[model samples]
Target: MTAATFQWLTLVTLTALTFSVAETGLSGSSILIPVLLATLLKGRLVIDRFMALQGVSGPWRWVVLGWLLLVLGLIAYTFLYS
Candidate 1:
């Protein structure tokens, strides 16, 4: 499949995974894993697809990816550890 189609699939899967995780009534470690996966998928799609960073060159793509990673990291840390 093309990159665009793959990205769309990733988004749909993330949505389903997030919803299932919320509905399953999980707690502790089990719960944290799916949430983290979904968050990472969102970051990947945002950087590689929605923002079109994958089509860019040099420092621009890295800068965007780095910023997204930082935000996603902070969110995951807060959600799991705090």
Candidate 2:
């Protein structure tokens, strides 16, 4: 209901998803999608909620978002290629 409650729930859901993915012992592309989705969702939550950047907009927000995307993209690329 409340914002804090929703945020906490989101975090818990993300954690559960991550744990489930790890427990499944999936290989190849099957592993990448769920893991990456969970990771990106978690990163966005931390950046927008915990970092308190959901409302304001500026270069800092762009920088943080860009960094997250870049790192995640590199990770996905590495996983897929290697």
Candidate 3:
């Protein structure tokens, strides 16, 4: 299969994994970290693949990826602390 097709499948798997973990009704950082990590991967896939930023140079991809990391890190921090 093509790279785009592979990315698409990986994205779908990550999404489903996130949902499955959520539906487990479990709690704590152990579960939270993996879910967040999966979300991070999914976001990167969407950014690089679907958004078509894989080949571009400069800071655009970094900018978007940084934004995603910041948001998700904040989320993890918030949940872990509170």
Per-model clash counts, in order, read 0, 0, 0
Ranking by TM-score: 2, 3, 1
Q: lDDT by residue for model 2 over 2-76, one digit each (tens)?
A: 887898899999899888888988878898988888888888988888898877867887789899999999999
lDDT of each: 0.79, 0.87, 0.91
- Over 1-82, each residue of candidate 1 has an lDDT whose tens digit, in order, gives 9978888888888888888888988877678776876777788788777888787767987887787778777876777786
* TM-score of every candidate relative to the true structure: 0.72, 0.90, 0.88
Q: After TM-score superposition, what is the CA distance of residue 50 in candidate 1 from its true location, in Å?
A: 3.3
Query: Which regions of candidate 2 fall more than 4 Å away from where they truly are?
Result: none
Estimate the lDDT of model 1.
0.79
Q: Model 3: how far is 3 from its true place, Å? A: 1.4
Location of the lowest summed lDDT over 10 successive residues in candidate 1: 28-37
Better of 1 and 3 by TM-score: 3
Clashing pairs in 3: none
